[model samples]
Target: MVANDYQYILENMQKELETQAEKVGELTKERDNAGKKIGALEAQLSETKVVLDELELIGDDATIYKLLGPVLVKQERELALATIKNRKSHMETELKRCSQTVNDVSKKIAKEQDNLRDLHMKSQHVKQALMGAPQQ
Candidate 1:
């Protein structure tokens, strides 16, 4: 009866270990995706800054063409600069949020990893005990 009880407990622990491992895998993927998003946002922000700088250097009277779905629509120089500035500002905000998400997810991943390791150790001990038990 003790052996049977140990067997049941070991089975439950195995299930829990599997569940924790799956969670860790999901969290790892989430962290990787957030990292990729941060990279993309940084590149976009850099491009926007370059465009804004170029616009600032040009004369106010100069004609600017805004690309709208492959069509170059005439736009006021000031308006174009303002639009680009807004885009840059928005990108900056998005980057900040994404960076924060990465940090938070990283911490969660670390915690989950530690939990998985501890569960694995406990499961190993249980397996050893189960194996050493006398068979019915």
Candidate 2:
């Protein structure tokens, strides 16, 4: 009866370990995706800042062309500047959101890892007990 109970516990622990491992994999993927998104956004933000600086150097009467879908429409310099600024702001906000998501997912992964380690240790001890060996 004692051996049976230990076997049952070991099986259940193995199943739980598998589930937690799967969850960790998912959370790790999510964190990686979020990091990639942040990198892309940062690159875009850098490019936009350069454009904004160029716009600042342009003469007040300089004509700007805004790409609208498949067409390039003529726009005033100020209007183009405002549009770029808005896009930069939006990208900044998105970057912040992505960073936060990465942080949250990282924390979850860490906690799950700790749980998995504890489960693994318990499973090992149970296995030893079932085999009638001293558990170290």
Candidate 3:
């Protein structure tokens, strides 16, 4: 009866470990995706800053062409500046959101790792008991 109980416990622990491992895999993917998004946003922000700086250096008489799809539409300098600044703000906000998501997913992955370790230890103890050995 004791051996059967130990066997049952080991089986249950194995299932739980598998589930936790799957969860960790999912969280890791999410974290990676968020990191990629952050990188892309940062690159866009840098490009936008450069364009904004160039606009500032240009004289008021300089004509600015805003790209609309495949067409370059003539736009006032002030309007172009406003549009670029708004895009930069939006990208910044998205970057912050992605960063927070990455942090949250990382914490979840750590917790799942801890659970997996505990489950592994329990499984080892059960196996030892089944073998008629003293469980250390």
Candidate 4:
């Protein structure tokens, strides 16, 4: 009877050991899953920081949007378009003023040309009259 009791105790201890080992294995798997979740979150955070840094750079310099903003970002596009429109409007006004100035100068030039023509005709007539009257 004593030998049988010893054998039963050893078998029960073996089953308990097996159960404990399975529990440890499950805990290890859960730890690895948690670690993976943390790693993914960290990577996403790094990407977000990079994007924010680029945005800060853009906001800092007014000149940056004209050169680098079109392909990379979309926030400052409306402001850039407004600036371009304002420049175009100014150029149109300047062109109109230049056109008016040119027109005025052309009219003045035409007036001068007409005056020269009249003077030339009068000079020719005076010379003809002088030559025909006192040929003796």
- The number of the candidate with the highest lDDT is 1
Stretches > 4 Å off in candidate 2: 2-6, 133-136
Taking the tens digit of each residue's C-alpha lDDT, what string does model 1 give over 56-104? Answer: 9999889899899989999999889889999999999999998999899
On a 0 to 1 TM-score scale, where does candidate 4 land against the true structure?
Answer: 0.43
Overall lDDT per candidate, in order of appearance: 0.92, 0.90, 0.89, 0.53
Candidate 4 regions exceeding 4 Å error are 1-75
Ranked by TM-score from best down, the candidates are: 1, 2, 3, 4
List ranges where model 1 is wrong by over 4 Å.
Answer: 2-4
Residue 62 lDDT (model 2): 89
Candidate 2 C-alpha lDDT tens digits along 1-136: 5556666877898899899899889999999999999999999999999999999999998888878899999999988899999999999999999999999999999999998899889888877767885433
lDDT of 4 by residue, 34-83 (tens): 45554654555455455445545564345434446456544464465455
Order of models, best lDDT first:
1, 2, 3, 4
lDDT of 3: 0.89
lDDT score for candidate 2 against the true structure:
0.90
Residue 93 of model 1 has an lDDT of: 93
lDDT winner, 1 or 4: 1
